[model samples]
Target: MAQQATPVRTARLGRTLGQEPTAVSGAVLLLPGGQEVSGRRPSSLLANASVRALGRRLARAGRGEGLAAHVVHYRYRGWNGGDAHLARDATWAVEEVLRRYGDVPVCLAGLDMGGRAALRAGGHEAVNSVVAIAPWLPEDDVAASPEPVKQLAGRQVLIVHGTNDARTDPELSFRFAERAKKANREVCRFEVHADGHGLRQYRDEVTALAADFMMGTLFGRAFARPVRDALAAPPPLGLRMPLAAGFGASLSW
Candidate 1:
């Protein structure tokens, strides 16, 4: 029988999960942008900088909103970079996070390669929402994409990409959103300020908007069509994306 993929100890166990349960407002599993992060399982986990930023920023959304966010930084074997190979692991990781939080509402956010994995993981029934930054959805970048995301159409999703990103055309993000929307899946689209996939120019703003959407969906406020449509609407040229301001939270990240 084939072995099931699992998240094991990092190359170095200096920083490890299941060591001491970290207190959190909600869990944000950080799937690395690509095999680079997966291979090294860097001792430099986002558990502190990035994930904490997201947790703290979302704190202002409301205290004890009964949410717990943790960063799922795990080491997976292999490097096929396809859903067929990684989907089961993704699903298990999502379940593990939910289990850690005692089954509270779960929200996912991924950047680059992380974005793709998170969508694949959360597209299932347990995950309540998703935020994919600079997402990569198409298998054959040069060809049309399959509707795998269609399974997630009924769930909340946020696809944020930079217009000038060359790794994958920014338009691919929209087309993915459109497919999900067409399936009647709920989604929100946002454009990061400036160009490039690093999101160096708009990381703060991007995470802030991401936090708002996450908190809203967690609290059941983001599911309304009016709100979803408002989010999905295209921002006029030069706008900062998803407006990052209307939500009743302070943008700290």
Candidate 2:
């Protein structure tokens, strides 16, 4: 008889960027992007570099508040359709955080495919917020298998997308934000003009916005006016809020 493959198991799948905090008020899990469909090959460093940088920035911004940041190392490198392997890994990371820290709030932050995972995993009880940067939402038959929105209730959700990204349609994320906002008033989205899938053109501004949102949601810091206005405004206006140049430099906190 042929033996089945053994499942991989570990104490943790997260790599802390800095020294692990002895005590944390809150935590952020940074998830990196991957392919649409592929085998269970391990995720690469190239894919994780950007999110790591974002994690470092967030750690610095929330250092005084005792925020612990970790970059989640996914077991597989693809979305793999309904399997949703990456999302499961994100959920596991949340559990790991709870095990180590004991019931502290967590923010799920991801880019590209990682963003989709963050959204999918936001329903976890310990998760207080989610920051999806350049999220990849599949353009399938919406009526048949639309991405879920009901899971986001009572959580602060922020979706950031680049208008010019060709890899993933920005419109799809807007549609998602619209649906999420209907179910949960705290859902908001920001458009990064003239940027691409990687969002490198306005990296500073995007990172700043994400940091602000994460800190505000996890540590109770006041959000910037734009973030507050975006969440409070009605429909189209709030869902399609524009992110301006030098917005990061203007942030007070």
Candidate 3:
């Protein structure tokens, strides 16, 4: 059996809202998804088991490569439509990483609204890559407002979406990915067969896929061929399958 890495320390810098700026720190920063309410901070990563679990997994992967992790707790907490609150916070987080680390590469990973924010902030010069897990990118009207996604022309991006996503349409993510691919040379899309927006059914698989992609993009490590093949493999029986935790099943992709 393969041994897992130890969990890294998580630090909370401070509250971020509007144009307020926070100090720079940490290697890879994580943001959790939530809605915009009144005068309260967004939910913490600990509140969301799935996002937190994914973060821990990524932390383990980065630990093996000497990378640290941080999670940004939003001030407003909501998408706020055209307000751009979430994107603003994400950009701030990236800027902090560069300010403290001095040109060090960073990867942004998010889910749902956080995913959209990550995509919006991926255009920054300091950001080397972005991973949007089941991002809430609606294609109806405001698709073009968040222009940073267009800036991913030559950036490395990974889009993970489930075909059965109920909250955010997977087709929208697919279309957005297609457009991103036309611009990005290293853009890759991993579609989860029948999982929903939360990806509860295949959380471990999603975490593994994300960790592998992040490690490759941020550290120049080669992704395992078996895992890559499994990701590339098509779904069996039309239902999404979960990849084993260590080295058990062969990756179809």
Candidate with the greatest lDDT versus the true structure: 2
Q: What is residue 16's positional error in candidate 1, in angstroms?
A: 12
- Give me the runs in candidate 1 sitting further than 4 Å from their true place: 1-27, 36-52, 59-63, 77-79, 83-87, 139-147, 221-253
lDDT of 2 at 227: 97
Ranking by lDDT: 2, 3, 1
Q: What is the lDDT of residue 244 in candidate 1?
A: 43
| Candidate 3 lDDT over residue span 13-122, tens digit each | 33322122233222566767776434345656444556666767777666645566666766676677676677788888887766666777888888887888888888
Candidate 3 lDDT (Cα, 0 to 1): 0.67
Cα TM-score of candidate 3 = 0.76
Q: Which portions of model 2 show Cα errors greater than 4 Å? A: 1-11, 140-143
**Tens-digit lDDT string for candidate 2 (23-80):** 7989999988988887756556788889998998898888878888998887778889
RMSD of 2: 2.0
lDDT of 1 by residue, 62-111 (tens): 34454444454445432354533334545666677556556666677666
The clash numbers for all candidates, in the given order, read 11, 0, 11
Question: Which 10 consecutive positions of candidate 2 have the poorest summed lDDT?
Answer: 9-18
* lDDT agreement with native, every candidate: 0.58, 0.89, 0.67
Highest TM-score against the true fold, candidate: 2
Q: Indicate the worst ten consecutive residues by lDDT in candidate 1.
A: 11-20
